[model samples]
Target: MILNQSVIVDIKDIIDKAKDKAIRLVDHQRTIMYWHIGKRIFEEEQEGKDRADYGNYLTKFIAEQLEPEYGSGFSKRQVELIRQFYRTFPIANTVYSQLSWSQYKLLIRLDNQDKRDFYVAETIKNNWTVRQLERQIHSNLWERLLMSNERESVLAIARNEKHMSDAKEIIKDPIYLEFLGLHREASYYEKDMEQAIITHLHDFLLELGNGFAFIARQKRLHIEGDEFFIDLVFYNRLLRCFVIVEIKTTKLTHQDIGQLQMYVNYYDRYEKKDFENPTIGILLCAEKNNAVVKISLPENNKTIIASEYKLYLPTEQQLIAEMKKEIEKHDYEMELPTS
Candidate 1:
C-alpha cells in the first residue's frame, strides 16, 4: 500500500481497487460453492419423501461416500452446517462479501434474525475480524448498549442506519482500554497511557464507535501568551465536528470540565471551519462525578462530555452494578422538580 507520487496516485488507487475486487471475487465463489452444496443436499432430501424419513441416515450415507473423496469437510455435521448456512442466508446477493466463512459460521448459528443481522451489519461496518466479532458477541455488546440507550438506538447502530446528531450519539462511555494491556493497579503517567492508546489507535477508535478519524495528539493551542496541549484531536465524520479529548488518570473535577470546555471553544473558533459543527470535548477520566458534569455545563449543552474509561473489562456483576448506578442517577434526575 505504498503511496505513489502525487502525479501517479491513480496507479496506486487502481491497483488497490483491483486487489479488493479479486478478494471479493474469491469470497463470492466460495460462498457460492457452499450454497450449491446446501442446495444439493436439500434437493436430495426432497426426492427422498417416499423413502423412510431417514434424512439423517441418508446424510451419513452421503458423508460416508463423500468423505473418502472430498475429505473430512464432508462429515455429516459439517454438511448440516453448510445446509444451515444456506437456510439462514437464503438470498445469495444479501450475503456480505466483507465477512468470511468463519464470520458466516458464527452468524448462521444464531437463531434470531434480528440478532444475526445486527452482528452482520456491525461486522461489515466496523471491519471487525472474526475474533473481534466473537468477542463482541461474547461480551453481549447489544445488551450492554441497550441498557444505556433506547432499543431504536441499538438497532440503528447495528443496522448502520443511525445518523449521529451529537457527541453522545457517537461517543461511548467507560470505553474498554484492555487493548493497551495496562494494569489498572499500575501507576503510570498520562503520557504513557496516551502513547499506549496511540500505539493501539485503531482498536481504540473501534471502541470509540463509528466515524472518528484521528487527527493529532497533544495538539498545541496558543492563546494569548500561554501554550497548552490537548491530549487528542479527532474529526467525527458523522457529526461533522472536531473532537478534542483530555485524559485524566484521576476522578474528574469541575475544573477539569472547565478546562475541556475551554479547549472545545478554542477549536471551534480557531481550528474549525464555518461549515463544520461546533467542536466537541470529551474528558476521558478514571472516574467522573455525573452531578458535577451536569452542573458544569449549560442547559442544553451538547459539546462537552465527561466519560469514564476502564483499563480492564469489569466482570458481569461489576457491569451490572455500574449500570444500576447510572440508572439510579437518571431516576434521580427525573425526580428533581423543575424551577
Candidate 2:
C-alpha cells in the first residue's frame, strides 16, 4: 500500500520567528554591552582626575588593545564615542534598548540637553528607526520647534503635555522639495511640479517630517456649483487635523491664499470630524510676497500658511544672507520712530 505523504513542519514560519527572536536578542545584548562600556570608561576617566588627556589616552589604549582581538568595531573613534556616550548619558538605567547605537551617536552629538531629550522622547513615542531619526535631525526639527512656538510652549509640547494647536506649529517655512530634482531657475508648470511630488510621494512625506499621512492627491470638492481640486491632502495624526496643500509654480498672489483658505474652511466644516481640530491650509509657491500674505489674511489667522517651496536646498551662504537681510529689516523698522 502506497502512503500519501504530507509535510507536518512549517519551516518558513519557524525560520522567520527564529530570525526575529535572534535579532531582538542581539539588539538587547548590544545595548547592555554599550551601557557597560560607557560606565567603565566613565569610571576610569573619573579616577584619572584629568579628564581631557585621560579621555584621549584611554580611547587610544582601548583601541590598540581591543582592535586586534575584536576587529574594526573597536577603533579609536568608536572608543571615543563610547566615552562620549557615557558622559552624555551618565545614568546607565536610562539607556534604551530600542534605540540603536547610531541613534545614540546622533543624540550624544547634540550639545543641548533639552534638544537631545526632545528627540529621544519623540523617537521612542513615534517608534522611529535610526534613519527616520537622522532625517528628522537633518531637517532641523529643533530649529523648527524654536520657530513654531515660544520656548516654554514648545518645551511643553516636547514633554508630551500638549499638542500643536495651529498650522504654524507644524508647518516648516520654505518646504524643501529638492528630492523632486527640479532646477531652481528653470521654469515649470504647477501641474508638472504636482506630478513630480506625486511620483516621489514617499520622499516628499519624509521631507515633510513626521505624523503626516497622505489622504488624497488632486482631491475634488464642489461648492457654489463650482468644482475645485486641491493639489494634495494629508492628515496629521499627532495634530488631529487635515492638511491641505496647494502648489504654485509662480509667485504667490492674494488669490492663491484665498483659494487655500477656502479649501481649509471646507475641510474644517465638512471633512473633519467633531473631535478633530480645524483643518490647515499650506500654500507652497515658487515665491511669496510676505507683505501681501501678511495683509491678505485676517489679523487672527492661524489656519493658513504661505510657504515658499525650494526645488533645491539653500546653501549655507544663501541662508546666512537671508538671515542677515531679515535682521537688517527688523533693525531698520525698530529704528524708525513710532508715529
Candidate 3:
C-alpha cells in the first residue's frame, strides 16, 4: 500500500513524539526512585541523630550494599549526593520533573538556596540543556546579575513572581564571548567581532539573555542624505523595543557613545511603532571609562547603555574585584551633594 506524503510525515511525527514521551517517562521514574531511596536513608539516619557521624555511616553502608548489585551510580559519593538532594528538596512533589538527573546534579552542588532556585526556574522556563545550565553556573551568571539588582528582585523575576520592569533585568554587563574563539592577545577589527557573533548566533543569543531575537546586521539608515550602518540590531519581545548594538574593539570614546545615541534616537523617531517602547542602544566595547560614559549621556538617559565584553569568563578573584569597584563607585555617587 502507498501512503500520501502528508500521511507519511504525520506518521513520522507521531513516532518521534511517542519516543520522546517514553524517554521522559523513564527519566521521571528514575528520579522518583532516587527520591525514595533518599527518603529511606534519611529516615534510617533519624534513629541515630544523636551520633555526629551516623548520617555518614548510614549513607556509606547503604552505598556498599547497593553498589555491587545496582552498579556505580549507587556508590558512596553518589549516595551522599542523593541524600543531600532530598535534604535540599524535602517534599517529593517539589522535585522538577522537567529536569534530568544530570541537571539536578549541577543544581544540588549550589550552596546558596536563592541561587539554586534561580537556576531551577530559568532551566524550566528556558528548557536549557545540562551543558547550558553548567555554563551559566560556571560563568557566575547569578553574581553578575546581582551586581545591578537586589537579591529579592532578581529572584522574583527569575521565579516569574514579577514582571520585568527594566532592561537591566535581562541585559548583562561585561558579557562573555569566549565561544567566539578570539584570543585576548590578538587584535581584531569591529567587523571581525561582529562576524564572530553572527557565526555563533545561538550562543550569542543565549548570552544576550531571554526574549531577544536577531533582526539585522549592518542595518543601514539614511538621515538627510547621510548614511549610517548599525553593526547589529535586535528586538526584545519582553522589553517591547528595538535593541541596537554597536561594536567597539577598543576602549569606548565619548564620540562612540554619541554615535550610538544618534542611532537610538533615529530608531525611536522613525522605526519604532506608536505602541512600542523606546529603542535601546548598547555600546559593546572592550573597555569603558565610567566617568566618560556617565558624562556622555544625559542625566535622565535610560535608553543608552555601555556594556563591556570579555573574551573569557572572569575568574572568582576578578569578579570579586569588579564587585568591589562597583560598590565604591556607587558609594561615591551617593555621597555627591544634590543641587
Candidate 4:
C-alpha cells in the first residue's frame, strides 16, 4: 500500500534525523577514544622521560599489540598523531562533539597555535566538511585574508563574530581563481570568465568570503528607451547590502570605474531597501591602475572598489610579493594630501 504525502514527509524527517544522530554518535565515540589513547601515551612518556627514543619505541610496541586485533587504525603513525593531538588539546573539556576524527587529524598537523585555533573555530562556524577544510588549508585562506587586515580582524572572522562596518571587510584584492583552470598567458572574454565563475559558483562564493548569497547574473535594467546589463549581483547578509560585481578581462580604466559607479548608484537608489546599508560595487579585472581608480571616484568614496583577480594560485613567494605591492600602494594612497 502507498503512503500518504504527509506520511512520506514524516518518514523523510525520521530518516534524516537518524542519519545525523548516527554520524554524531560515531564521531563523539571516536574522538573520546583517540583522546584517551593520547592521554595514555603522554603518561608513559612522563614516567620514562630519561629514555631518548622511548616514545617512538612505546608507540610501535602499542601499535603491534593492538593492530593485530584492532587493525590499521592503531598503527604507529596514527598513534603518534593521536599523542600530538592530546598534547595540543590537553583539556578534554575543550573538545566539541561536532568535530569528527578527520577534522581533529588535520588540526593536529597544524604547527602554529594561533593558525590552528583559527582553523578549528572557522571549521565549526562554517560547518566545513573534511574536503572543504583541506581546500581552505591548501589555499592558505587564513593567511590570504590576514594579509588584508590586522591580527585581531582574523580572529573575528574565524569566530564569525565580525561586525563589518565597511566594504573593505568582505572585499579581497587579487582574488584567487585557480580552480577555474584558466592560464595566465591566455586571454579570455568577459562572458567566458562569467560563465566559468557561474559553473564553479560554490567555490566562487567560498572565495568571496562569508555571508555572500548570489542574487542575479547579467541582470538587465530598462530605463526610458535604453537598456543595460549588469554582469553579476550578490547580497551580503553580514553587510546588510546589495553587492554588484562587474568582470573585465582587460586592464581597468576610468570609464570602467564610472560605469561601476553608475551601477552602485542604481542599486542604492532602486534595489536596496530604506533600512539597508549603501550598495557596494566591485570591479574584478586582470589588472587595475590605482591611479585611475583614485582619480575616478569621489574623495569620500567608500562604496566602490577595484581589485585584481589571479587566474592561478600564487606560490608562497609570489603571494608575499603581491601582498607587499598592495600594502605599498595603500601606504602611498594614505600619504597623499587631501584635495
Best by lDDT: 3
Question: lDDT tens string, model 4, 186-208?
Answer: 87899989999999999998888
Question: Model 1: per-residue lDDT, tens digit, 197-305?
Answer: 9999988887787788999999888899999999999988888999888999998999999899999888877889988999999898998888789999998998998
Q: lDDT for each of the candidates? A: 0.83, 0.81, 0.91, 0.86
Residue-level lDDT of model 2, residues 245-269, one tens digit each, is 9999889999999889988989988
| Each model's Cα RMSD | 4.5, 4.1, 1.7, 2.6
For each candidate in turn, the TM-score is 0.80, 0.85, 0.95, 0.90
Evaluate model 1: give its TM-score.
0.80
What's model 4's lDDT at 59?
A: 93
Candidate 3 local lDDT, residue 222: 90
Worst 10 residues of 4 by lDDT: 142-151
TM-score winner, 2 or 3: 3
Question: Local error of candidate 2 at 312, Å?
Answer: 3.4
Provide the clashing-pair count of each candidate structure. 0, 0, 0, 0
Candidate 4, residue 18: CA error in Å? 1.5
